[model samples]
Target: MRQTWRWFGPADLASIDDVVQAGAEGIVTALHHIPNGTVWSPKEIAKRQQLVRVRKDGSPSGIEWDVIESLPVSEDIKKQKGAWRELIANYKESLRNVAAAGLEMVCYNFMPVLDWTRTDLRWGLPNGGSCMRFDINDFAAFEIHILKRPGALEAFTPAVVEEAARRFAALDDAGQKQLARNVTMGLPGSTESMTLEDVRAHLAEYGNISADRLRQHFIDFLSEIVPVAEEVGVRLGCHPDDPPFPLLGLPRIMSTASDYQAILDAVDSPANGMTLCSGSLGARPDNDLPAMMRQFGPKVHFLHLRNVKRDSDAISGSFFEAEHLGGDTDMVALIAAILTEEARRKREGRADWEIPMRPDHGQDILDDLTRRAQPGYPTIGRLKGLAELRGIMTALGHREFGLQ
Candidate 1:
């Protein structure tokens, strides 16, 4: 596996120098400054390439941009409404531009409204580190009280609804505001500045859109673009729905193995692959991470190797990011599964045998807390995770030589 890092461009707290020092061999970033539904000009792409290849002192950084973390699937494209056709054209052009610049493995998601949601950004741990968390009761409270979306109560179970009501009743205005801020923070990465009204409006639009309808829109998107991906020699990987569940009564189409199966069946091309995110998929107890890897390994073009500890056995419950090997998912088994896939690809003479992986979100520890880093991305924490994963891969690689 090729270890990589996700950098949010120049404004990111984690600098390009940090990536090099952390031992990441590649950069996973995008033209975040570029607005959605616009073509990425080759000039802009080249500028980013140059920035990634050199340090501020003009010395080599020993890494270049490898994968585009995303190329933003616009809301227009997701709903197949408004100027969707124009946006899709822009996307195709962007695809061509990136491929022409010698980059492959583009990642995107089809989640409507919010690409991801979390109720708490700085949940305290017993170890004194802070990590992001999604408590089900708090989330339900947001739906029933903060955003106050129509029909929000019916979306959750009766027990959850009751718990949400109790939780909402306990909060004063200040707590309520903080809860709202945490949920809406997902807007930044989704690239939309939506107020509560804007969120209401977006939810209303999807109110009439069913799960099947949203899924067809996703498939409709791939049918048009996957051919272009194949022609451009780039693999387009759709990231799974974060948390892997429905939120705000919005339809979630990419939450399970079956969802991915349908997607692969619809497009049925090597270019149409999965960005296997273990954290998101592992949030659900039903999703066997290693099994899914073995099943979809051939079509998985990207990897987000992180772990989470769910509070309950239920699919839609609270969970938090855990240490790389300390979560519900078995890190050893998962890495071994990933190696099996690489071995198979090597035997088949596939050029993309070594998959690109990045240590996903990490807890805030030591200087990480004072660094004011991106919510889920912290320097020391993620480096710790990468080190652990690297250790596992190394041991697994040398197992035949008695290293195991």
Candidate 2:
């Protein structure tokens, strides 16, 4: 795996120096300063790439921008009815520009309304850092009690609805405001912004579109672009739906193995692939991470590795970010599967098989707390995660290949 870090460009609190110190040789970033639906000019892409590659000794080692975390799909694109042709065409042009600038992997998601959802941004960990997590109850409270969109109550049980009402009632005005922001505020890479009205409007766009409809929309979008991606030598990896389920009455299409298989079958191109996020799929017990890795290894172009602890009894279980080797998903088996795939690629002489992997969703710890880092993207916690994963991969390599 080629290790990389997600940097939010120059304005990010985590500077390029910080990324180098964290031990990644590659950068995963987007042209965030550019608005959605606009083409990222090759000049802007080169500027960002130059900034990321400058070494501490002031030499340019060409630390490349290997992936675009996302090129946001405009609201019109999602609806597939209004101004979508223009947005899709612009998106393809952006892909060409990025490829022209020498980046290959482009990661994006097609979730209808929201991206990743976290009920708490500061879930305390035993090891002194705080991790972001989702609480089912908190999400329910947001949907049923706060956002209060029509038919939101149908998504939860009666008990959950009652509990959500109680939780909503307990919040004073400030607390309620914070909860709204925490739930609705678009995280990095997601383009959707939410006021209560905006959330309603977004959901309404998906009104008649069932899960299959949304999936078709994604397939249509990809069908138009994957050929272009292949022509430009840019691999487009679609990130799975976080939490792996429907929320707020919106249909979630890319939350399971079958969903991914459907996507690959629809596009049937090597450029169309999966991002394979462990934290997203790990939330569902039925999603065997190791098995999925084996099945999708050939098509996975990127990886976001983090783990979650799910509880059957608790609707809102506490999830503290664990060391890479400490999570419920067997890190050993997962890495072994990835390594096996890499070995296969090597044997086949495929140059692009070493997928770019990053430690996703790190805890906010140490000096990171003092500085204003993006939520779940604190530097030290990710450094710890990267260090741990590196050690595990090393040990696994030795055990599997008889290296010292």
Candidate 3:
């Protein structure tokens, strides 16, 4: 595996120097300054490449941009309405530009409205550390009271609904506002700034959309974009839905192993692949992480290796971020499965045998608490995760006979 780190642009709290000091070999980032549904010009791509490679004093940073965390698929593309064709053309042109710039892998998601959601960004852990969490009742409170979306009550059980009502009754005005902000903060520049009116209008547009309709839209999206990806020799990976469940009356199509297999089989191309985020998929207890990796390893183009400790046995139970090797998923077996895939690719003489991976999220501990970094992306925390994952990769490579 080639180690990588996700970096927001120049204004990010975690600097490029921090990435280098942490021992990452590659960068996983996007052109976030550009608007969604716009084409990425080669000039813009080159400018980002220069930023990643060159230091402030014109010295070398000694790392290259390896994978695009996303080239976003627009809302118009997801619903297949309102100038979707133009957005599709723009997406294809972006892929062409990415390839022309010598980058090969791109990651994107098909989740509607929100990129991800969590009720609490500062869930306190027992060890006095802090991590992100998704408490079911807290989310229900947001739906029933904060956003006040119609038909939201029908999605949960009677017990959950009653609990949500109680929770919502306890919140003061400031608490209610903070909860709304936390849920909408998933996409950095996109929905993070949406007002209550903006959120209500956004959910109303999807009233007529169902799981079947949204899925077909995703297939229609792939049928058009995957061909261009194959032609340009770029690999496109679809990230799974975070929390792996339906929320805010929205349909979730990529929450399970079956969901992924269905999409891969529908498109039937190497360019159509999976991002293989362990933390997101692990949110569902039914998803056997190692087994899924073994079955779908050939189609996985990129990796986000983190862990989550679920609060209950139920698939939709609350969960909080865990240490790299401390969560419900089997880190040892998962790494072994990935090595098996890499060995097979090497035997077939494939160029991209070593899949790029990053330590996805980490718990806030030590100096991280005071740094006040991005919610899940503290400097010291991720360094700890990368160190643990690197140790596992090294041990696995040395123990396996054919692994290098």
Ranking by lDDT: 1, 3, 2
Q: Please, what is the whole-model Cα lDDT of each candidate in the order they appear?
A: 0.89, 0.82, 0.89
lDDT of 3 by residue, 202-295 (tens): 6777776889899999999999999999999999899999989888888899999999988999999989999999999999999999999998
Residue 255 Cα positional deviation in candidate 1, in Å, after optimal superposition: 1.0
Those runs of model 3 whose alpha carbons end farther than 4 Å from true positions after fitting are 188-192, 399-402
- What value does the lDDT take at residue 49 in candidate 3? 88
**Model 3 Cα RMSD, 1 decimal:** 1.4
What is the Å distance of residue 62 in model 1 from its true position?
1.4
lDDT of 1 at 314: 91
Name the lDDT of candidate 2. Answer: 0.82
Point out where model 2 deviates above 4 Å. 55-58, 189-192, 313-321, 399-404
TM-score of 3: 0.97
Candidate 3 clashes: the total is: 0
